[model samples]
Target: MEKLHKPKKVFVPGAISPQFIADSIAKHQSKVNIGAHAIFLGQIRADEKAEGFVTGIEYSAYEEMAEQTFHEIREDAFSKFDLICMHIYHSIGLVPTGEISLFVFVSSGHRRAAFEASEYIVEQIKTKVPIFGKELVGPAGEYIWKENK
Candidate 1:
């Protein structure tokens, strides 16, 4: 695996900030050939559970397997689409409500390919990766493990 693919670091300790996302887009401005860029941001929302309102989420993952899975997904996306570039970031640890936990960016020369590739990568990550999360609910610090449905 080391020779085949050097995995890029994907997990951030906390929430991904708006500034970071803006900075990433700004950095790609020099690549004038890229006509379309699609971005997917997974945000933690305060959902009303049967017990109470879910306040936040604590994410965890089987790191080694997840990294390998991500690499495979990236390769598959590149092979399927005419993409300029793609980057995926997922948050680990605690993320408060209204914060972003996952960021998937895809760039291409055309809009359709960019959109399709982005959606494909995101769905693959959600279903294929070994990442797990627990929904932190109520005022008493109770939590319920979440499934990637």
Candidate 2:
């Protein structure tokens, strides 16, 4: 297992690209012990709202606090699950509809642990992290602060 305490870079400037995700998975090919990897991608949706349809999402956060909370969530996941490693990335700026905003990848020796831990990590991030999203709802740039459900 890798070292646990080092803080990882979790924030990307915009949408999480497919190339980035492919590269991440490619890099893990050397870890033969990892039998399964669970990945969760959060994509921005073009949902019709009272104002208009959502065009995109602009994400912002208190960087320091968000990073700390992410680290805490990582630690909790490590302690609670039989994980080999995990990675998480979230968008910081504008992500257009149908683009990825969040990526969560969890690896383990078996499938069940990886799947369950990925779910738990995603739930923790959605509920506990302080990241905020501003939904661009109209063509005229009207927006609303998104609330976590």
Q: Which candidate is the best by TM-score?
A: 2
Best by lDDT: 2
Overall local distance difference test of candidate 2: 0.94
Off by over 4 Å in 1: 1-6
- lDDT, candidate 2, 68-122, per-residue tens: 8999999999989999999999999999999999999999999999999999999
Q: Report the lDDT tens digits of candidate 1 across residue range 1-149.
A: 23333568888888999999999999999999999999999999898888788888999999889888999898888888999988899999999999999999999999999999999999999889999999999988798997676
